[model samples]
Target: AFDPPRLSKRADYSGQMGGVSEGEDVLARWSDGLLYLGNVRRVDSIKQCCLVRFEDNSEFWVLRKDIHSCYHPECHTPPIEPEVDPNSWICRQCVFAVATKRGGALKRGRFARLMQIMKVRLPYQLSSLDWDPQHLTNQQQCYCYCAGPGEWNLKMLQCGSCGQWFHEACTQCLTKPLLYGDRFYQFQCSVCTNGPETIQRLPMTWVDLAHLVLYHLSLCCKRKYFDFDHEIMSFANENWESLLLGTLSDTPRQDRCQNLLNALNSHKDRFVSGKEIKKKKCLFGLQVRAPPPLSSDQSPFIAEQPINITHRRRSETGAHQDLLISTLNSVLGTESIQTPLNFSLFVILQPFAKWLFDLKGNGTRKALIMPILQPDAVT
Candidate 1:
């Protein structure tokens, strides 16, 4: 099995960073690219990952490269102030799920915890054509200077501000290391680092509705799907005029208002919305049902060949699947996916009840479980 490249320069066989003692304390990086309080419970020597149990009593395996420390176990001197918010503690997995589900529509509260993840010692000058979905949001390893598939072996660094990925070699970095392996630094890309003359820097304290949408949508596109509904509702809750003005507001690209729906229609492979319609006997009596949420080809195994696995079952890579289910179940505040109750799960996932209820009439087990995997089709 292949492993992803970790930024760890000196990870060790022992659980903690640099072989700090077992059951020791450490900071763990979540999907949104920020560190939070967690402690080392055990180590997966084979995967070179650690079983990190966070302060909230949630436990999962964090890649060794994603683990670090500010003041404990490791000997280090403070250069800059500790960056992560003391009050920013929340369910890290929940943050990951919400961010992924909404395509990174982070509300101001959840958005406040954003901090520096890694610095691009070198910057990639992107062409006007470089801003497409393929280059920016689609890849696992981003914020870097390449178009290559994510290589676990490569030493990679990600820009904390814009979330652009960088290959260590491209950074031309010799000095100015992470200094403390804390997984942090005030890093920006060429576009961001070049100063406000080149682009407006998103304020660290208060990011308005306009900036949140544009910044997350335009830059740091780790999550591709932007929740326009969330953006508008958020603006509407505050001020409707701001909603309209915010969409038309200036962006680093100096983009025109063509981004309203055109950009979304083009960038996202699909859009999903559920609505209940009442029919009062139409003139033609035509079936008024909406199109199938997923095409048969996409939502396969409802009746046929299976991926040969279930949410409970795993294959050669099943452990990872198990880990995901466990993490999501924990993050979602659910007991098990086998019992996907609406109140117990995240609101975004509430629709699963209806879908699964309908699916139950068909085949059982894997056949029912398979279609639920296509998130693109489901969402």
Candidate 2:
């Protein structure tokens, strides 16, 4: 039987082991890229094997030739004195990862240990930390609006409401990156968090307003009033041109006035206001104005308001006047114009009246005069 090489008995074997003793910290290079820093638990000189335990509580046995003293004078700065507890060792990679992941300053003990080991200065400014392998594997993949799937990039943000992930490019949120010190947790998508409905509802440009006016005029001509759909078609058919022209042209000076009139006359009983006709109903409750009398000077002067017509009733007058004023202020850009009651009423009601006349001819449509008011529209 062969005898074991005992360090106490054989001085040559002790010299060959490179001074790595039991219960001492060591750096072991197991492969070209893999390196482990651990405490030497046991030394088996008979088998030329050494048992080591790492910070992550993993143990391995390696040949004595692979292990180096943790404080090797040539490789690292020699410690002032040997550490009292060999178990208080931590790797440089783990120290940095822990500091970054916690988003806080490094621990005092770990910092002092790191200073002793590293010849170069530690870069504390680095933001990203290596995620724990087990934690990374357990995390759910992020899904972007474009259907891309992966872990969140630095530029990706999560919506607190929907639990969805979106890229900064997709969200148009090109704001600065959130700092660790900000302590912000909640985030919301644009649609989920409500804003002014008027922003989406209000017309953006003059062309948009023109389109809305034309749509509402067309609806009136079609007798598609929500409350009373049954009405005389003569009123709409007769005065369709005047109504269409007045409503469409803000100043009523466009050459297209005659063209629109001709179009309305040609269509007669069948009027198509396009696909989105339902949304045009908001302005339909406006009081119609009677056509202006022929101007003697031919300068297109404002119309004179009619007086004491038997058709004008006392109960409906107040409501109609209120509706007319609000419509002129909100829709027709007439908020600043101050005038007598007759002139103001004439200016406001003339376009609507012409449209209503085209819908019902000589007889007035009660439905056209009295509209179902929206709650917010009043006052």
Candidate 3:
């Protein structure tokens, strides 16, 4: 609703003027009485200049003294309203609605960040940097590819984060159209472009730091345990994934590690799912369940760790102890699940077998339990 005053008469006085520029530092003189000014400050009080062209393509400059309200060139409808009273421009109702919807005016720190994100660059450099989008308002526009399919005007675009606009080309990949998804827009920047050479070219930003933190947590879960004992040694033996995701090891502080460990431990119950088998029970003492069949591809070996064996005689009666051994031995196939019994081996492997069951989860655990038996060749 910007309304400029109607010009009563033209003034001959040419005072020194400073205004926003399209490109060059000098003001372009139009055929009509208009002087296309440059470097104008972005102030609400100083309104946009409207240049009216004559029959021969000459123009006359109309300052705030010549216009009442702006109309869309096509629709002729005023989309924005003017400030009725600057002294008390906002009413209580409007102020409350704005506050309620926007969650309050943005803080200056966030405001500056938004401005920086939306800044764009020109293909060619100019002497004065005043023409940059960083200094313009949302309504500002620069010349676009005049000969392109669509005669476009590169408008000052504002970022959703910072409410600032830059040339569209400067901020996005020009090779393809952007794809917008449900929550956020997905567009490849210089950092996300594919190819080994391109990947090498990527400049690290805050986004890279955020991704590193998430990836580190993921690998820790896969390894079953988070190990940071020897950083130098570990890095030497680390894989490609570790190198790409190894920012955490550089820091001396280990305070945040507990939080990562706690998260993994908390989710352990949800991680594994399997059946607990029941075995033959005696009158005096209870027998534990049989070992469940391993999922396909899983090995009886939970992992490559050393087998830690400990035995305790909770009951004095020989019958109770013998029963426990009998059940555990049977699980280890010592009693020859089908052929012959090997009692000593069963006792030795029982403890490690129990630990393997504890780590079972989804397909990985199921696959782990199943042994990778090799087929025997016919003689």
Candidate 4:
């Protein structure tokens, strides 16, 4: 039998190159008819051996003592050094999940990912757009900037405790800076940042809520979904008459009344009140089937009066859906009168409407869990 060309020891051996240590599994890759092993060891003073070891504990060695270089003549630079400092470096395997770019995920690389995640979360804040589902009665139950329809360009919001994700616009509050390595990055928004520490979070002023509701209503109108079933649109239009009069009443009630009369004269052909019916139905439906009451503990989620509510119906069918909606419309529609009557209406009817639609479904879990393969993980 012929002896294989084993890596026999030469006359000289330095053993300088750090070869695979005992108990360390080695990796090998073959390309262009050449075998590349994980480690090289010098076994002879005048020659070197390429040692190959398998994850299963097999081992083999080859002598390259007399071989010349230049396998790829086109390549000019020598191989780069590996990262010895674990703190400053992450393996290529861990680089995929970061967003280190100027705009969303437009850029990549470990460093960039770290920076991008840090920027949005940092103390310096960016833009905010408020939103509330017209269908919901409790103002606190309205979706905030994160969950609303604001376009975050698909950017994700990171959770405070678990490094999980949510749509950027849906997040109510967040903490800043994702801490990794030596540096920390600020990332949480105002809501997340101030939530627990602060006292009763003031309700979003009616003005701000109105603006948001109106803006979306116009958007829906543009889409021709004139189903007139949107609570938001109904709210805006119902308030439209009162708001206009209120705004102008600041000038003079006479001037405000004059404008209303003139407008009614010009559009005499338009059955504005008949149109008001459609708005009423939608508003009533929303107030009836709106989301459940937010926890009283959460100051941010409280319901404020002077909201839009349109109609009334008996809670005969389980669809208390329609009745709940009507009650909400009536609550929202009632004038902000400083009388006992107005207060009574708000206190009595509003809670009932909110209860009808306050359906709280358990949230879905979408967190990602990485598997560990070491004893340290068990610890």
Among all candidates shown, the one with the greatest lDDT: 2
Candidate 1 regions with alpha-carbon error over 4 angstroms = 1-16, 70-133, 136-377
Minimum summed lDDT over a 10-residue window in model 4 is located at: 177-186
Candidate 1 residue-wise lDDT at 192: 48
Arranged by TM-score, best first: 1, 4, 2, 3
RMSD of each: 17.7, 33.2, 28.5, 26.7
Give lDDT tens digits, candidate 1, residues 136-164. 23222223432222322123344444444
Q: What is the C-alpha local distance difference test score of candidate 4?
A: 0.28
Poorly placed runs, candidate 3 (over 4 Å)? 1-160, 169-172, 177-379
- What lDDT does candidate 4 reach at residue 142? 13
TM-score of each: 0.34, 0.17, 0.15, 0.19
Candidate 3 worst ten-residue window by lDDT: 144-153
Among all candidates shown, the one with the greatest TM-score: 1
Q: Give one clash count per candidate, in the order shown.
A: 9, 16, 27, 46
Candidate 4 residue runs with Cα over 4 Å from true position:
1-117, 120-202, 217-379
Predicted candidate 3 versus true structure: per-residue lDDT over 1-379, tens digit per residue: 2221111123211221233233223333221112233332222233445454434455444342222221232211111236345464333212212221111122235432332222222111122122221122211222211000111112111222222222332232222211110011222222122211011111222222222332333333322122232331243234323232245435343533443334323332112111112321110110111121112111122211121111122232233334434544343445533212132233233333334434432223334433421111100
Candidates' lDDT values, in order?
0.35, 0.36, 0.25, 0.28
In model 2, what is the error at residue 67, expressed in angstroms? 0.5
